[model samples]
Target: MGKPYRECPHCGAHLDAGERCDCGEPEQQEQTAAEERPRMRLIAVCREVDKDTGRIAVICL
Candidate 1:
């Protein structure tokens, strides 16, 4: 099943989980802020060799 949908109280627009309608109401602003918050992710870099030829490639994530 998909996430339940909610309606914006101010604009009566449909919203998904952690989503806000375009009305930008104060109540929705807080949710939007939390959703817009920056998050940290792990990136990996590695060296790989191709089977066809003897070469090294640097991969960046």
Candidate 2:
């Protein structure tokens, strides 16, 4: 089965999974914050906020 998914930075409106936002985005854009994620916690989606600095959080699989 496919994995449960989250929204694309371009696609997700209310923060849900999708390939592209209805408003549209550039192809150069990468996957959503979730897809780029290495993994999610077993129970919950990790909450992270980055204002500046190096990669804030580079998810390592």
Candidate 3:
């Protein structure tokens, strides 16, 4: 009935036979790279101070 199509492994886009998908393109690579890295946020900071020596320690979560 209809022409056969295949799914792109990288982006899951349906492509016609012999067609190329843009998932491996430079812009897509940059986007994927950004997505793969872990993102962190500074929730809180805690400080401990010694009474006699006046030494301080910092803890972050």
The most accurate candidate by lDDT is 3
lDDT of 2 by residue, 1-61 (tens): 8556655565455534554455575444555755787884564443465767433444543
Q: How do the predictions measure up, each by TM-score? A: 0.32, 0.18, 0.38
Model 3, TM vs. native: 0.38
TM-score of 2: 0.18
lDDT of 3 by residue, 19-56 (tens): 99987878977889999999978865658888899877
Please give the ranking of all candidate structures by TM-score, highest first, separated by commas.
3, 1, 2
User: Model 1 — TM-score against the truth?
Assistant: 0.32
lDDT of 1: 0.76
Give Cα-based local distance difference scores for all models: 0.76, 0.53, 0.84
- Best-to-worst order by lDDT is 3, 1, 2
Candidate 2 wrong stretches, greater than 4 Å: 1-22, 27-32, 43-61
Estimate, for each residue in 7-50, the C-alpha lDDT of model 1 and write its tens digit: 88887888888986767646777788888989877565557888
Superposition error at 14 for model 1 (Å):
0.6
